[model samples]
Target: MGLFSFLKKKSDPADAELVVLDTRLRAGEPSRLDSEAERERQRAIARATAAKIDEIELAMASDIFDDEPAWGSAARHPAAAAPAAPQAVPAEELPDAAALPASAPAVEESAILYANGQAAAAESLLRDSLQDFGRHERLPWWMLFDLYQATGQEAAFESIAIDYASHFETSPPAWQPLLPGPGTPQSAGVAATESLCPVLDESIAPRLARLLASNAPLVRIELGAVRSADAAGCAQLLQALQTLRKEGRELVLAGADTLMTTLRPMLAVGDRASGEAPWLLLLELLLLSNREKDFEESAMDYCVTFEVSPPSFEAPKRVSTAAPATGSGDRFLLPALATGDCAALLDAIDAYAAGRDLLVLDCSRLARMDYACATALQGRLRVHTEQGRRVELRELNHLAAALLRLLGYGQETGKLRDSLRLYPHRY
Candidate 1:
């Protein structure tokens, strides 16, 4: 019987026999069917249905797989028809499918593993991939570099750097260790305190002066919170910075780049008829931060605008030995990975956000966030945003940013959710 005929005759004697035979096989009993031809036909239909289910599942899960070739093309052309394949393209013109790098899966897998605290497994997989396809792919190599740096495996990082340079014929990534994990003890020094406020106006100058008055050798100012700045505020803050530099006090300008972004629009290159304080402050920030390239460019602009010599860029005399604090003050640091319900994380965020109008979640170390956690976090953020409070997620990795974007935290119209801000990691 044909496949469809067998399916249509559901109540036939042959169907009953097939059911009984399937039940017996499932129970590990030997089948004693006498009709060999009928049994073979039933088995063929079963295999076909199972294959169809697999195809359906694949199509549902991923867009890469096409079901038309298996279902439509086969049905349109009978198996008896001879296949036509006479076209021959030059070897040079042929697409090199095998040579194409398949790095996304490997990169995502390694990132998830590392985020989940499975560093060893992630390292092993990266090493194996490097051995298998490292010559053709640079992503795995860079991932391995990041892994080593994150894990503080300096020796292994150097070893890989040498190999990477030789293989890629270029410089490998620099070893910039991430901040210590949560609960890691601060080094033996006076810990830097949080910023005074989120906005940089005339009022913040006195607060900064007080901070400078303190005897602490290392002063960390959270400039990331400064969303706006005025001339008076900028001048005061610049004076304080100059004092700190002259006194040789260790200064850490957290979020200086963010402050520069806020200041850039206030000053035009060579059109700086006013707002000289902001320009000077920007130059000071670049100089103190040891950003020579940025300082040089701004210095040239300063000279053209002010018709005076700009300050010379100076390298930092001493580097602070203390480990830089992560997520100071109102900022909550998300874990390396967030999955499942994430109740504890949500609670921590609530506690941090309580009695505060601005909520900053530092996601620099957050490598991956599953759908469930992303949903939970989005619900919490929505409530906070509706209550007229601002929420900022800072330095999120690409993977977590993508998931948040998927959940509607960031929209395609260049606007985020109401009172919500997402600062994805740069490079």
Candidate 2:
């Protein structure tokens, strides 16, 4: 009989009788038909039943169920079934369907574009942003102000100043033109002189006097190297500054911040133990640098410390100088933007680095560097490094630093010659 026929006979009377006989054989008790031959027959029947079960299981595990749709074969073999068509999602149900990507702030974008030498685009964007968002934001206004001043747009600057004053209900910032563009030589008319010393002590009093008596109209006293000051030095420096002001001579205090840092710690409110020289000198420096707010605060402190009347704030009458160069005579100040043909800039740097083993380029005013200029500068600095000389690019703004980094200037490396050394801006 076929396997199906044999399985169908499981419910037959003969099959029931065999099952009864098997049960009796398994009991291990003597039966009326008990014999060795009967026992062997029962054992063989039991083995054949187990083999049939194993065969059924093996068939089920194979492809035997493929033709049996009643057993849900489609569910068991999903790959064989066709996929259902996708249903469209409602617009409201879609994730972030109306959300747009966030963009950089208008002021930041304009500034970066200006730095990258896209002055027209930068100015246009600033103007548009001023119209759309200027009521709520002040940065765009200030940026436009600086842009106009830098580009020498006096009429536009004045027009915006009027709008600024009317909108903010206050006086607008004055229009001060920026210094000559990058690579332009300093004018010969101003006889500029530099004084380099490590400390502002009593020993330098005679030199200070000479500076005061000098015929040169412009004198820059390098205070970056000054680590400490005494009462005598402070008083002497104060006297020279006063004399210069009385004579209407131009004075630039290079690295005044560094000296201020050294002086601030030695001073305290209601403590005049260190005398008024340091206090008075710091106040004078603040005044000469056109820092009225800082001067006022320090003046208040001086008043409290000395129990005497503090000097009144006086705006510097001289033409406002550029940001104080922060180092000695060897330092080279980079312009606000380095873009387009930077041949003159590179030449100026070469001239500055000619006599010095160390090249110090100050980027305190540097806002951005175009790709070509950055590449050229990288090459120049690389040559300087290869010659066993060190190059320090100091006080770099974040934007300028990012460009230099993109050009592979300052890389993480094992040797100093491999990359440019960058000092981040202190502020």
Candidate 3:
């Protein structure tokens, strides 16, 4: 598994090794570089690698157990053995081995890798196992799809997507475009939901709204731990939201879980529902392509419809330079980041995260907001709507907000935003 690290560098060693590369030592004699002996050596290496893999595969194929055995007799033997690390997989992480509920055979045990916070390692594991798993057992297709997209492996993702679609007609989206806008479009070319609710920070409500609006076929609504200010009836809202999302839709999510709702209050953010502001300059790149006269002017109609300025980033800032202001009355700047400085905002977040007693960022002014920002942030981050729409800190400038957006955090104002923060419940 760690072998890929060895292959990353492309043939760059040292000057002493350079002369060794040019000469072929056959039977302790220096010969031409492209000699038969060199070709024979390479073929031998390939055969050894392949033979080694086959031997390991055969050994693994012999066992069908709930837990992998630590030491095998085959492993200790010297004559017929190839060095093989025992394939260790979490028993609980896999599906019930007693009953797969799946039509596939039990010849090779299929493993489901559930590494939250272990994203990088998971990707590497899946990639290396892909070719072998196709014939023996299905790798966690959903995860593979995610890993492919996160690491920018489009071709690999597409191949996996096709295989998955052929196996299960209505699977989730490929990992790319994980944080699409509330009104983003889907590609008909691939077999996937044009959208997904990642449940980490992606606001499912906004994604649901987009799916409902655009009429995308496949949808995944995660109802793990959604909550609202009305503590007693939070479950009902979670159920209702799912039902509402499912209505007039092609699929339904049916289940129960041990998840409990711990609701938070909706914190206020900035007033860039219009997606304006100078620091989010990359966003300006999109506006540069905007041909419609009403694109920016009318854009607020969607997100601004409930905007809240938030405060926070983690960088440090120097307030000597003034930041560009959004339309004035509706904007607030968090004290730490309000200078319209990303460096300062990140610094403040870093400080706060490290136990510094400080308001890392805040909205300096009072501003009106709509539901769109909260809902949009929730959808983008894939957090439960009730969970996603809250702002942890406040007062966002366009740049700070944009950085958050690019990184999948958001400021939520208005009712939806209100649903996020921790608050006292009403009767």
Best by the lDDT measure: 2
**Model 2 lDDT tens row, 257-307:** 678888999899989888999999999888876778999999999999898
Rate residue 373 of model 1 by lDDT: 78
Q: Could you give me the TM-score of model 2 versus the true structure?
A: 0.45
- Candidate 1 worst ten-residue window by lDDT: 67-76
What's each prediction's clash count?
0, 0, 57
How high is the CA lDDT of each candidate model? 0.62, 0.63, 0.32
| Regions of model 1 farther than 4 Å from truth | 1-187, 319-427
Model 3 stretches astray by more than 4 angstroms: 1-125, 128-139, 172-427
Full-model lDDT, candidate 3: 0.32
Q: Please write out the lDDT profile of model 3 over residues 1-427, one tens digit for every residue.
A: 1323354344434322434554545347664446778657655765675566566555654463212222111222223444556557422122111222244221112111211234455556655655555344333443355445434577877777777545433343423222222232221110112222213232444544444554334332233233322322332334433353335332212111111112212211244322322112211212222213333433333234345332122121111111111111111122221222234333433333332222212221111112233334334333333433322333232222222333334334454543322110000
Clashes of 2: 0
lDDT of 1 by residue, 73-142 (tens): 1212224333434436422122111211434555557655665567788788879888766666555675
RMSD of 3: 25.6
| Clash pairs detected, candidate 1 | none
